[model samples]
Target chain A: MSEAKTSANPLFLREEELRQGIELLFFAYRDFTSEADAMLAKHKFGRAHHRVIYFVGRHPRISVSDLLDILAITKQSLSRVLSQLVTDGFIIQHRGPRDGRQRLLELTEKGVEMERQLTEAQRRRFARAYREAGAEAVEGFRKVMLGIVDDPARERFAQSRRDGGRDGGRERDQ
Target chain B: MSEAKTSANPLFLREEELRQGIELLFFAYRDFTSEADAMLAKHKFGRAHHRVIYFVGRHPRISVSDLLDILAITKQSLSRVLSQLVTDGFIIQHRGPRDGRQRLLELTEKGVEMERQLTEAQRRRFARAYREAGAEAVEGFRKVMLGIVDDPARERFAQSRRDGGRDGGRERDQ
Candidate 1:
């Protein structure tokens, strides 16, 4: 029972109202990634590489198939990007302990540092926004984001937070 | 002010907490675009095209230079994308009335229809999320997004709403 619920207009789903939300999402996401993107450009890498490094950092021994599922990119696309990462030494593949044929992905020390740097650039925005909005607004923000993402199953960090506590709030993508 | 302000932990800036925010942003943004991305694939258009259409739709007579500034892309990149949109008949170019050489961009009728479809796919998620979160949460969500975006000067929709009422609530990058 929010005050906004009782006092706010319920008919905010009109096309115009919805358009504003769309614009906010566009600007927010664009600006959000721009910082990390600049850092990536220095390495002659792009978003594809940033994503591979990020997910590998998050999942630590993530299988190629699993990564393809999460990234929703084609194997050919991933192969091109993955090969570059391997050649450049940002990522290394390991044979699955149980399945010798499987290639599991993990980040190298250099890869980890890149991931940390990228995360740090983007994290500053979230940290500032969350603090400025305060806890209630942050809760509302996450709730709306959860709905927008439409993948509660994928947001394992949120799930983990609910089940317990203190797990470096990063998404596991597992 | 709010209950979460008092009830929630004040010290959430720890690295783990910050990292979770990063993860949520990654998943939320990725899923947010994936739906529209599917629609884009059907038309052989990518995110770059979607952005051009969306912005041109938002600002009907947006000039090329203004667009370049808003998109933060190189002239070479915008030229490739813009020419395609014009050739494909999704957009039309006009010479500025006052400035003979100024290239003004506007979406053609076909472009408008395409823009609507793309926005429709994305709007569904926001509609559901805003409704489920209630008005208060929606307010909170907007506040947080405002901070994350850090472009109050650009989000003229929120400003216009503050000045009065009903404006179809779309951002004007001008």
Candidate 2:
């Protein structure tokens, strides 16, 4: 990690800088989710539940397999929280129109409301960050974060960005 | 949210861009932690355990209260993970030299080894992100992330940044 410590050009990729990057990520993520976490706790749900809600809201009719892939969680693990959400009227899963065996997930109106509240809280924080940093800094932030994102997910996300925020149901991988 | 959707400067500060930023954070953090998560899971441990080990490794002789503050979790919640780590020989507790009543914590050699492995994985990703984005973009990433970080933590983190990653015990807030 210290391999490049002595290099000029003021490059900040040394071990020290790298560790700072890691710590910043930890602190930033904690603050970003802290609010929504408290909100989820009020519903007796956890971060896993929040992930399901946010994704279902973002990609209406996203299939169970697709969601599992996106969340990278096992079926059994996803099932417990998912079943609770459905039972609580937060999400509804329907049989795929084209395939009876396929389960397509969507947020209930109640779920959408919850999603909005959660996402709005997050977006407010992100917007303030962007506003404070200006347009150029925002791009740098995205570039670095996108680099942190693994491929395929990165590509899909970029596509969503290019799509101009037309979220959900539009690209349900039918 | 859509208030600035039609601005002429391509400001990317509208609801669309804001939502995209939110999604980027999700994807980036998931990818960042996924590897370490898998590693921790192999030991039947969870993210909570990882956080305890990482902080203990970083801050030798840190008291229980300071950890609770950094984690922003309940004493009961942290106690479960902390005790588990201690029982598992990953952490050790001692009476603070200056304050016998203060229970100071440090990582065992085994724990330090684990911390190095876990942190090395994360640092590699962050280094690649920094390398890919270059130094100019690195500042942008830090600026945006610092904005996401809430008060006091942000200031504390900046101080650490200025401290050049000496880490832990030096700033134990004794």
Q: In terms of DockQ, which candidate is strongest?
A: 2
Q: What is the TM-score of chain A alone in each candidate?
A: 0.82, 0.86
Q: Identify the runs in model 2 with alpha carbons over 4 angstroms from their true place.
A: A1-13, A165-174, B1-13, B165-174
In candidate 1, what are the lDDT values of residues A110-172, reduced to their tens digit? 999989898887778888988898989888877777777755435565545532233234423
User: lDDT scores for all predictions?
Assistant: 0.76, 0.83
Which residue pairs clash in candidate 2? none
TM-score of 2: 0.84
- Candidate 2, residue A158: the lDDT equals 62
Off by over 4 Å in 1: A1-13, A152-158, A162-174, B1-13, B150-158, B162-174
What docking grade does candidate 2 earn?
Answer: medium
> Lowest summed lDDT over 10 consecutive residues: which window, candidate 1 chain A?
A162-171
For candidate 1, the lDDT comes to 0.76
RMSD from true fold, candidate 2: 4.1
**lDDT, residue A109, model 1:** 97
Interface RMSD of each: 4.6, 2.5
